[model samples]
Target chain A: MMDDIKELIEEGKFYFLNQKYNEALQYLNKALEKDPANIEVLYTIGIIYESINNPDKALEYFKKVIKIDPQHEDAIIHIHSISENQ
Target chain B: MERFVVIGLGRFGQSVAINLAKLNKNVIAIDKDPQKVEEIADFVFQAAACDATDEKNLRDLGLKNADVGVVSVGEDISSSILITLTLKEMGVKKIISKALSQVQGKVLIKVGADRVIYPERDMGERLAKRLSSPQLFDLIELTESHGILELLAPESFVGKRLDQLELRKKYDVTVIAVKRNVPKLKDDGSTSFKESMILSPGPDFEILLGDIMIILGKSKGLDKIKKVK
Candidate 1:
């Protein structure tokens, strides 16, 4: 099960780095379904939402990451920036 | 070679003084705080710490010969009004004052201010417009009735030729330019987005997704185009 999750995460990261946001999202979502408590997957999905100009969705995911790990520096910063712009 | 007097050393006043001086105009910057005056002394023609509301102090600064006076002390309406009045009485050709509210703006205009500016209100309006229409990049008012605007091409315009749309005849606006981001590879084989512009594209040019259209025409015409699906 862990190997499957790792493979899905690697594929998602590859698509994201290549700017194929939709494919990256599909893989990331599949990985999240397999391992619902993955903090990295949640943060990466938030970044994808932000890049696609959906700040509200981005903030929703970032807030969830903060709830799970209060010391998540990147998520905290993203939430603050998204809130300031809105 | 006209002289400009900026009465206030706040952010707005300092910016006005520095920009005027950069344009090779003679600028006199004044403020009640010595530190503020000293901070900008090197950049302006002259910097003085004096009470701007007092007509005697203005006269002592040789402001009577100034061609323009900008009063940015909007914190106190009384002082802003008094400084504007003193500048008007001093034979300054133009007096521009900052007003905190619409009522204060009216009062300033009534007291011989040639122009009254509301920095905060104007910024708020621009921010609201940009937030409401994410596609609108910029809007510049050229005159009371005309404006130049840059906005992302609406989805309907994609895959259509410019002439086929007959934008000028139908919407009464001219497409001055179109900007697009094309994918390019760098020397290191890294892919990047390169911005390209087609100035005054002819009839055969096809609109593409992610194109930014810069249009120039009456504000009403632009508003009409914006309403198109």
Candidate 2:
């Protein structure tokens, strides 16, 4: 199960680099389903949402990252931005 | 000399022409009302009273070669777009039309306005920010995320050099420039001064009395910067 998720994550990275946001999102979601605690997967989900102008959902994921890792500096700033813009 | 032909003579039109004129640019002020035309005569290179929606009148006034033609007749959306289309078709290089609503603005852009202005709405948004913020006085919103604004420095910066503040790390902002509203010392043997500005200032500068600084930051970053104050 872990091996499958790893291969999917690598494929997601390739799609993200190629600007295939939907494909990247598909694999990212699969990785999250396998290991929901993965910080990089959660952060990537937030970035994908933000790229499409969905700040509320992005904020949600960023908050989750903060809950899992309190010292996450980017999560702190991203939350600050989302709140201020709102 | 490039010329700006501002049509309508309404508040927005007048403001744009006056600001540009203050910048020492050539302005051709126009209005359908003779009184408005007379009011701005001295400030403009030329002032005239003419119906801007009328293509023949605009052509006769040599507005086609104008560097910009702003149609500010938002009271009547149809007239605004008509003037914009006329200006575009008449070979005016740039066309800015004022619109009362988003729908009106879209129509003007579709009809060939290079840009659109919403005076009442834009002012309302600006004033709303001022009303909500305890510290922010004026803002120039560049995007949803970015803005350059005039703000009072937080107490933390009362007597410190700008470099020490480290706004980028502390608050995620960049202080592009500092403005100190110090009084200018006149050519007198006595000690007296008049309120003035120093612009594009540097890190060596220290914040002082009556200073209204210009700051740049993300929208959220500014809130943190101000909140710390």
Candidate 3:
């Protein structure tokens, strides 16, 4: 199952790069189910959520990513952006 | 009431004169050099050679009667400040002075200049920025923290629609408009259609290939939004 989740994460990133946002979200979700604490996957999920106009969800994911990796530059930047803007 | 005077012909001076002229404002472009006045003759109602620091000549030009005045004496800091003070003494309604330094800026303001512009310093900063970030295309300052920008679409937003991207809600920005090159036909011979046209620009617009977008937002929000990609 862990092996499947890893494959799903790779597929999700590929879909994201291709701009297939919906397809990317499905794969990301599958990865999350297997390893819910995966910070990288959570950051990717935040990207998807922001892309889909879900600021609240995006902020939640970014917060989680920062909690796991406080020094994550992207998360720190986005958290400030989300809080200030929203 | 419509007439205005610009007393310098440097880059900053010329840009101001041209902008005012392009807006159909009645501008009088004056410079000490004959060549400077001649070059911008077409861009203004009148162009003449005049030393702006000369108080007598400023009064002769009816500085009090003119609606606005801009002192663009860019080369000589002393001359610019003296001209600004002279214009204020002439009781010009709006005296916009160009400053070469912070001290100059403060001096002009103290001399009763309605507004002070740091054109050289500002442009130097902008040029430095232009050299550093090749990815960043253009910037328009709305406030200290907020700005509008026309950036090359980021790698992350390549195929997303505005509604889907939800950038404004997430990042405090709105995509005001997009410029895309569609097949444009020239010299339409058909009477039915006199002009070539852009296609599929729906009211609910979708992002298309090679489209450059105009975005409005707080600068910090924009920086964050750019980072996610």
Model 2 spans with C-alpha error above 4 angstroms: A1-86, B138-150, B156-177, B183-210, B213-222
CAPRI-style grade of the A/B interface in model 3? incorrect
Candidate 3, residues A1-86, lDDT tens digits: the string is 87898798878877765556678789999999889889868988886665543567889999998888889887888779766544
Task: Summing lDDT over every window of 10 consecutive residues in candidate 2 chain B, give the lowest-scoring window.
Answer: B183-192
The candidates, ranked best first by DockQ, are 1, 3, 2
Q: Stretches of candidate 3 above 4 Å error?
A: A1-86, B138-149, B163-174, B183-205, B216-221
Over all chains combined, what TM-score does candidate 2 have?
A: 0.59
Write candidate 3's Cα lDDT for B74-146 as tens digits: 7587888898888777777798988877888898899878998877677777768755754455778899998
DockQ of 3: 0.02
Per residue, candidate 2 scores C-alpha lDDT tens digits across B1-229 of 7789999887778878888898899999889999989988888888999888788998899887888888887598878878899989988898988888999989999999999888889878876876687356667889999988777766668677777877778777877765542222234311112334666667677765335677888988876766756
Q: In candidate 1, what are the lDDT values of residues B127-214, reduced to their tens digit?
A: 8987898777788899999999887788799779999889999988999999875543346432234457899999988886557889
What i-RMS does each candidate reach, in Å?
A: 6.5, 23.8, 17.3
Predicted structure with the largest lDDT when compared to the true one = 1
Per-prediction fnat: 0.00, 0.00, 0.00
Best by DockQ: 1
Would you give me the overall lDDT of model 3? 0.74
> Who wins the TM-score comparison?
1
Could you estimate the TM-score for every candidate?
0.65, 0.59, 0.59
